[model samples]
Target: MGKVTGFMEYARLEEGYEPVPKRLKNWKEFVIGLSAEDSQKQAARCMDCGTPFCNNGCPVNNIIPDFNDLVYRQDWQQAIAVLHSTNNFPEFTGRVCPAPCEAACTLNVNDDAVGIKSIEHAIIDRAWLEGWVQPQPAAVKTGKKVAVVGSGPAGLAAAQQLARVGHAVTVFEKNSRIGGLLRYGIPDFKMEKSHIDRRIDQMKAEGVEFRINTLVGDLPKDGPAAKVTNDATTTITPAQLQAEFDAVLLTGGAESPRDLPVPGRELEGVHFAMEFLPQQNKVVAGDKLKDQLRAEGKHVVVIGGGDTGSDCVGTSNRHGAASVTQFELMPQPPEVENRPMTWPYWPVKLRTSSSHEEGCERQFAIATKSFNAGTGKDKGRIKSLTTVKLEWKGGKFTEVPGSEQEWKADLVLLAMGFVAPIASVLDAFGVDKDARGNAKASTDLSGGYATNVPKVFAAGDMRRGQSLVVWAIREGRQAARAVDEFLMGASDLPR
Candidate 1:
């Protein structure tokens, strides 16, 4: 340990955000990163616990203690190296990951946990600024071809790993841009697209090819819709991908949004979080979207308390909404988890996101009864919502008597989370799916990522269902190893 008693000496410090008034004016990253000295002190607080549960706590199994020591010792280069060993994109996780590692930290038994995420953010950003991040091309090409569908974190991680192992990896994205959800589904204010752009450049230099606007199923342009690519006539099909590539890995995200079937769901102002988020990201990317979904001067009601819902609140704040309110069916959780019982595991507790801190009226234990859209002038537009308190008994949720109420709501966003991967893409490939609609594949080493369909593999949200970005990266990296081993008899890539 760099400083044996550093944990006792230094308290945890986290990055602050710009003032709400100043930050709401624009869609940009508002987090003020910790200074170098402060970051070092934060790192020094990492106690030399015999068992570093933070490593296992992290989805990607990040080498937390090693990097902490490296940072404390002023070894910036080594810190970045250790950090990148497990995570392909620390910048993404550092900014958005809930930091379960902190929950599992031994020091967190009583006092504040070490500021691991903040230190991680500092290391990666510093590495980029110092030009320490570079392309690590394979020594020689293996003459093997690998097709990775979807360019999300999972796809990107797999592509990078395969490319490093001498495989000719090609990442195909259906979108106009390379990044799948990262470029679209996430708001720009949470994470700028520039990080994805720079990583794309690094991957390109490492011999990984990127195909954008390449819809693999029906061929967007030539079939029914207009051509997606500029002046491109031909479109690629799933069958074509099966025949052209040596092995195929499905790394697409779970895009099937959970819909609200209640009345007024089809209203003009009602929308899925995916639809609303991507448009903002596109606008941030310099592509103007006509009639962008704005919550300006309107009562914005976001359903669901997950990250997507928080994003809606943040975006609405930027849009200058008349009022923002979020609803969660579940009751509000305790501010702090009972760590003695829940140690080393993610516990049920309240999580206040940066967006939540910005502003929003949050309500829990309340369920929306129905949309109160009158047959008046506002026929197709939402006007108000009828909600009531809920009671759980005998495995059923019942509405409380005399608890019904109506609230003004001009715009509503459903951010309840994705149910499964879009069935169309899975059906197109004829890939077997689990009961949950995720791709059927065993994670065993013998079979690796091989699905029922030979040479077809699945990873990320496609196989595992909806999950965090870090888990997606882990799956992608592991899938890459499985693919490599299947192709070349054995693989040296890390799991």
Candidate 2:
């Protein structure tokens, strides 16, 4: 779809980042994007593979080759239009998404894949700079009201699509701000909140109403606390929303984080990654935190080796921690994938994120056995941790004998991952739940996204489980189509 032989003529070039020392000093984005010429040349590498596996790899089914071709032809205006046709927030995905599409690119079989994400990032940023991005309000109002509970990616995408298609949409956010995780769970250095601010402005101009700091139903009482930057005092019942709106979409994310049940878990120096991350984000947003979970001059240990754990590492480094270490219970993956076996599919391999590159020691196949508080006035605060090595055999982990050791630890952050959506809101809406405790709904075309309640639907992490931002956007768009069809007897919206 791009220049026919461009892939053979040119090599790949990655995006740039600021120096570690300079970027660590402040909570701001540091990744420098591709130049116009660089992006155009990269786009020209698209092979026009007859069956684009990239579409399948991407949850949103982005028309990758067509957009690449458009960019190569210097039609920047139409490039963004084609992009927006499938995804609501390219800017968000461009910055934060792990590009599965690139992995599935045709060139990836024997060469570097087309820089699809970089192309996308360049397209949206250029569109924004050129004033090509604007609100597309509905030509006619449908006289139907949709109450989207949660302001995360799914809710935002659904709200925008429904609003553009003429539905009166009201977004209810438990947090004081419009963006849910985008505004709170994510750190500012990774993605500045201003991106969300601009999108919210566009959504508002398109006739969407936002009710921030308004909690729907009640929060789950037990679990690794899913902390929020929003200081919400307002509460709205499921019954009130059911009565007021013609349709309701439950897009609240998976809020219940998995916990570590062990000795000294209640120690003052130990906290969940959410608790630590949200506080830093709030502080970066200029909110004052009272004795917040600072890692300065203290040994910090993060329990988990995923993005959340990486985020903890970056944040702690920024706080000037004495030392930082990350532990993963599972064995480490190979540095590179075997392309022949895993072509066009996500492969299990070691990934080093930008945060990992900043500074931190990583340990694999290790498990925390216990914790201890030294004898002092701060006896309830953790001062040391006991851990053990593990061996994986037959899909089970067995502790290695004589491998137990103890180390000094002043702070600990639990980042194992999320297990379920907060049970309270789903229970309040009377929506059935899957075995894994997420809101249950089908994805069939006829009745997809409909919850047990007649007019209530569910999507995103709240309905599925913990996943990438791109998946959440896909669910939101699909659920919007389902809601539109249910309200209008049929929908012209994309599925």
Candidate 3:
């Protein structure tokens, strides 16, 4: 709305990236954010659509048009204020969220959508550089204690909101570090760890205590689910939390990865993506690791075509793998979606991430049959795997006859995505679970986020299953409001 006709005058400007050759050498953010002038031009492209669907399209319902107008007018401080008013961590969403807001933009119906994510990146990065981001401690204390189990986006968002509302909040993390998924799951090439560190510092200044390496519930001593990253030295039970805190929020991620239970799955080098990813993250954080899973000089095969699989591709390339190949069970989507039919909604289209661009041979509609072990000296280690092509017919996949094949694979990383949260934590709390194994909780305004168990709540991936970080933040903020109302009988915090 800042420039009525600007949308017609300007073409979309995409963010730049470092050359693949130079970026593959180190683990660091490679995106080149838009300059102020470029960001202003991009923001000016926002049209005065009668109903801004982008607001609702965003999981946190960010005030998109307002921030766009502010950026167009070169109001940097105001832009960040609008951004933070909705999203607790624009740096995380700006870097990793797959901009559903842009997909719902009015301009996207006929032309390129506004570069909203890039503008957000510029705003937050600029705000940090200008010292606009600082601690916002409460003036008065409520003396009520709240326990947040998990330190990912959802837990962090909820803790910040409750702390700002004058409640004493303590976040418990099982890992040695604060950030659960953001610290270990995401590669540094996508987003640096320093972003999470600064936010932790700010939260500490706001009176939110973070207890790292603290497990609030029991975890399986051994199993596939046990492979989840955990370094807890202290374990607290549900009864202790219920007695000590006025409210308990379960915000842990969906850590139970889906497995391929084919023959020879027990072979060495066939590991879950989590098992391989966290080690590299620790190594990047300067934690020396022995027997680290390295892809160097190995034929790597990453199963599942998703963000996690793409991340594996990037990491494998960084490790100087001999070859990297990715497999997808579903058929490849169209290169471009039919905008006329799917306007104002997320569409199914082929996506090529930066990791895929680096180097990866991707195969679609392929299913693994079994992992094959090597012979003699290489016994017990995976050497290759059998696969079969599939054809979709009558809503079912029928294997193609005579299409069986074997491919060399010294390392097989299963990244088929997480199935649910670990069940032990919910069992410890005696919280009910949905059919999908996620904590059973509603999002209604009345009694929202409350579990069947008394004084216990659930949100984020723990409640909604695997989802975007933006959605996690939204659930966390809303859960905080719900808890506030439950504790005080009313709340003024924004949903």
Worst 10 residues of 1 by lDDT: 223-232
Model 2 spans > 4 angstroms off = 225-230
Clashing residue pairs for model 1: none
How close to the true structure is residue 148 of candidate 3, measured as C-alpha lDDT? Answer: 99
Best-to-worst order by lDDT is 3, 2, 1
lDDT of 2 by residue, 220-270 (tens): 555554353447789999999999999999998887888898998888888
- Candidate 3, superposed: residue stretches over 4 Å from native: none
TM-score-sorted candidate list, best first:
3, 2, 1
Candidate 3, residues 6-54, lDDT tens digits: the string is: 8999999999999999999999999999999999999999998989999
> What TM-score do all the candidates reach, one by one?
0.96, 0.98, 0.99
Per-model lDDT: 0.87, 0.92, 0.96
Cα lDDT of model 1 by residue, 415-434, tens digit: 89888887767888888999
Model 3 alpha-carbon miss at residue 236, Å: 0.7
